[model samples]
Target: MRLLGIVGWTFCAALLAACGGNGDKVNTPGPVTPGQSSASISSNTAVSSLSRSSNNSSLSSGAMVMTCASVEGAVFIDETCPNWQEPSVFEQQKVNSNIYYEVPFGSDGALVSQKIIDSGDALYKKVWDIQYNNNNDFNGLPHFRAAAAFPAGVDMSAYATGKLIFDIKVLASPEANPDFTVHIECGWPCYSTDVRIPIDELNTWKTYELSVADLIRDGLKITNVAMGFQIIPRWGQQTNTHFQIDNIRWVKGSAPVTTKKCFAQHFDRTDWSYTTKVETVDQMPLDSSKWLAGVGPLVTLIPQWNSVGAAWGFSVRDTETLSSCAAKGTLSVSVLLPSAYVDDGQMQLGFYFISRSGLYYILDGIPASRLKADEWNTISTTIPAGKISNAEYMGVYFDSKGSNVANGYILLDNFVITHSLVQ
Candidate 1:
């Protein structure tokens, strides 16, 4: 699922523009007559079309712009973008290898030391030294994070059957077993599962290798690798920690195959429930409990329409945790619309998942053509590879075009999610 903030903002903007109003102000449309043409009704509440693409030229005006100063074949680094800062003295210079050092950041008063120093060994010339104090009062404790980014991204499809290799040493720590995590990121909200690193012996260099296939199974997009990896110290540990890292590279190798296990929800049970947030005529109150029901072994949703042609259907919740396995799969649902519900071209239907932190992951809505009148139609959206384990609620939503018709409802069922797993 894509970030909902951008889509929600665009949707609201189109609604306001169609209503001929300014920011935060909505203009109520006049009532429609029986003889009015469908085109006339659409003119009052038409929603503009928006698209997103990976090519820089296809990006919308609202998309974040990144300035890449490095060449395509070289390591990616940018100092001009608003989201990036200039490299500090502690950051290591780019070498011929895949690893490009990045400056580390941490909570206030938590960062104790960060530097690149020459290694005494003959093979490894330089290494990174990172130290932090996690006992600070901020949030009861502080945290530290360092990242390796590929601003222009690299197509690692050629290394599909390879391995990510690195070397590390735990120099000093409060606990005998120091622990940290490495997260391979594709982009914002797109990350592999936490690859934990635990050190049992201190001051001893060790080499570690992880399969590329395992990372891919855990939701890492190999084609467009926005960030190679990120290192984050575990939380709630009030102690000082120090570690050194070197020789981060990707090597060609053979990896074991993996399979996937899927789970689905039919929405045929009678105990299902829904919550409604809709606009009705005269802003009249609505009975949330009466908006949804199980009929004919299928779930049905009823919407409350407002005078200005704005309406929202019921949001049905899934009782199980299917969002956790949404990557490398599709989130789909079946819907049936009545013929009386005129197609205004602006109607949109889709699914959404909300995280525990209240962040919304919403798929772009399917067009009106995908919804068949008087017949069941399957609408699906690809769930992008990302971190969605915190998703607490998954539901369906529908936004109607500015139609003045009343007594409109829809039938929904067969919500499903399928994904891959490492055996």
Candidate 2:
């Protein structure tokens, strides 16, 4: 199949390395208490006048509180304090105390429109109203990030036993539902795994909590935390969507329990069918299906560099409807690279997927150094729950990077699709 020109190879390489790749290990933080001080709050009078209650808090004047909770032992991040008429403390970068900024990782022509919604007649006073539009350009995977920084690197050791809490409501979304990720960043390359917001819980104001210990376990440094909190949209969220966020804070307690189960489904050799497309180069026609083969447990893919800088790969699809396996799924396969290609390092192999929406999902770069020459290396990529639920045709695609080495062939086997479900 012809790979869409959505993302450039260099940009994809950097994104893969920063998102989940391994990096230099740092010293782990020492033991921490549950309620020790970790963050600094601005001297805003409005924030200091709020009264804490057992379940929620309200202004001393008895004004209603729209947040899920504002109890004792809680550190406020951004409560939308001082009303909406005043200037916002949040910015596009970290400059002072009680301030946050966006990562500015080119949004692929996505336009972000913002406004302060004054809900005087509702439970809350005001909130942030943000809308995202892709502007019809899907050449790159756009990223929407709002990162809050801690001045002088606060000691968040106390919250290690608690959870990061925030309130969100989705007002609009595309046909394919999309979720956002929460991150705790210490510095460059030091970040937590993408803690996704539940796709099923949207359209209404709801409180979402993430365990701080889980963030630490995923390489987050709570001791000398530079950026305390962040919210980012996951990949394949290209269409228009509208959402609202409020009452960001860190509270001392564990998250509420829920009943969600996840499992995996392995695809046998018979489950996959080979597919290819015809190409014309220099007035000569070439068909890749004639060169590719699928036998027993191994599927061989030979790249055809029809012209200079040309890119193509072999594909196999299974028309099985995996709508039930929603939440999040990971597709994995075993690839054995030829010794010649591994030694030359002129070409790179990467994994891509075709979502039910016909959107192409590409994984991080698979450098030669990461692959075992002449040995099987497991390659995988994650599919969002929205795409997984609407999926009718599932498949695995192998794309080559450069056009230098066109002779070496790759061996693929062991196709599997794993996902979690809310039972």
Candidate 3:
């Protein structure tokens, strides 16, 4: 599938220049559109275009600014930049072999394999040149590469949440490979898996988008994602095909609010741990005077959590037990946690609080799974005002229990305190 394409519109220069309102200096990309050519296309194509649009007179307050940075070779890092040792000595040697690192792309001269050299004559170089111009698969052989270790540390057991986004296009030429392939692989010292994508085909440019959410849904993690591409076969395993690639961008993507927020930042997991770290939560004492819910234990705090149908509810019985319900409320509390807990793939933890309700609801469900075991995870809860009318304390509980006893304990450290008025 052509993963991502223009949502509905293009950032034409005239349109962009018209976006600026009241002289808010906006930035834009250069004059070249998808298929257009530039005078100094080699050394300054991307940079020059970005520079020209730096002072875009037309910018809208509501429109998001899509900035372009050099998309060369690079890897994602975390907020807590921990000391990282390369996962393998081979990684060091392989990287050293490349003339230049091209990121989602690949090392320089990566396209030059023995086959191209063997062809030697002009016909061979023509084929090689055509492969680079028309092929979608660039940087196929020396696939995905990463820093020695994750930004925080190397805990292959822990899940890492990451994201990537970039624009891709096809170059015009007589000699070009219409069909191309790019595959992302998790490499060395870690389990291997690949997601291959066909980028350029028959003269077209498009954007490719992928997220950690996909991994969570598939029970995977960000750390397992690596960059690489597949060379389309010319004939029966010949293994000598080529492609061109540019504008590759990869980064950690945040979860969207459209879905149930299930298994996202709170309890998203990879491996056995519930991983999507809640790096931040809004928590504080609730205005116990009032609480409301759609029905049953699913309570809400009136106008406080005004975004009806937007927030989640969890009834806490005690530290390790919970009653879960989907609720809408007015006054409520949210707690932001550190990234460690969100992306770590934790499976269990406990919250402590007292409630006024006779049956203090212990409402808890992972953001993704019904109840996953061993994997790292995260969870969030909203206590309506009236729900805690009589009780004084309460907490969200975490645990890892299943067919196996080895994954029975959970750990938690970051805490947040904040609340909203009973809406």
Q: What is the C-alpha lDDT profile of model 3 across 1-423, one tens digit per residue?
A: 010111121112211111000101111112211111111001111100000111111121112222223222222111101222211111112234454333232223333331112223221121112132222323324332343443222222121233333333334423244333332333322221122233335334344443333322222233344322222322122124443322233443232212221111111112211111111011222332333222111112221322212221232221111222122221111222233333434322323333323223333223212222222222333433333333222334332221111211222211212222222
lDDT of each: 0.44, 0.42, 0.25
Q: Estimate each model's TM-score.
A: 0.38, 0.38, 0.27
Q: Which stretches of candidate 2 lie over 4 Å from their true place?
A: 1-110, 136-152, 254-423
Q: Write down the TM-score for model 2.
A: 0.38
**408: Cα error in model 1, Å:** 42
Off by over 4 Å in 3: 1-140, 149-163, 170-183, 188-196, 224-240, 251-423
User: In the order shown, what is each candidate's alpha-carbon RMSD?
Assistant: 20.9, 21.1, 21.9
Better of 1 and 2 by lDDT: 1
Q: Report the error of model 3 at residue 407, Å.
A: 41
Q: Candidate 2 on 25-65: residue-level lDDT in tens?
A: 21111221111111111111110001000111122111325
Arranged by lDDT with the best first, the candidates are 1, 2, 3
